[model samples]
Target: MRIHLDTGRSGEKLAAEWLSQRGYTILACNWKYGRKEIDIIASLDNILHFIEVKTRRGHGFGMPEEQVTRKKLKNIKTAAEAYLETFPQWRRVQFDIVSIIYAPGGHNIQLLEDIS
Candidate 1:
């Protein structure tokens, strides 16, 4: 349980850096609404992004993005709605997923935008 938590935290950190390099300024990380959490929230081109970061040590189970289920998406959407209420300045919003595959040599990251 602890290992998974650690990996998730690490993946979120990596995702923040990756987004920063690509012109996204991270606003909040691990931000929550009720019981849901947004891994990374960023802004670019006047659009606010709510990101979910999934990490995996191997592909034996599946790709990181594959783990984002319908229920998870629903929760994320609800969380985004709540977040939007607090940050009304950001009228344009996007839902994104950052999948990280952490392996021996290095890590592979994939960003899927506008999932919502």
Candidate 2:
């Protein structure tokens, strides 16, 4: 059987729905600003959340959260700043990473929040 890696997109979709179920208003997904892309942008109670979604099949390689490097964090921060500039009314903001581990059988997916 052939297994294709569409982890990034799948993770983002899962994260968005997860947030929505918790009452977050999703403002954007896969938002691109120049060369940077934010996986999910959401707000709840006037607090903005900039999210990064990481997905892996298992720990055979490494944990999904381990993929976010310092440079990647820096880029996400810069992108958040740019996003904030466009919506200064946001009272608070936070950065979060959603780690998803999906099994090969398409079941037993687990989500870890704020891994960063």
Return the clash pairs for model 1, or none: none
lDDT for each residue of candidate 2 in 12-114, tens digit (9 for 90 to 100): 7887897899898999998888999898999888878888888877778888878889999888889989988998998778888877778776633344444
lDDT of 2 at 115: 40
Q: Give the TM-score of candidate 1.
A: 0.96
User: Which residue window of length 10 is worst by lDDT in model 1?
Assistant: 82-91
Total clashes in model 2, counting residue pairs 3 or more apart in sequence or in different chains: 0
Indicate the TM-score of model 2: 0.85
TM per candidate comes to 0.96, 0.85
- Local distance difference test, per candidate? 0.92, 0.80
Query: Best by TM-score, which number?
Result: 1
Question: What lDDT is reached at residue 19 by model 1?
Answer: 96
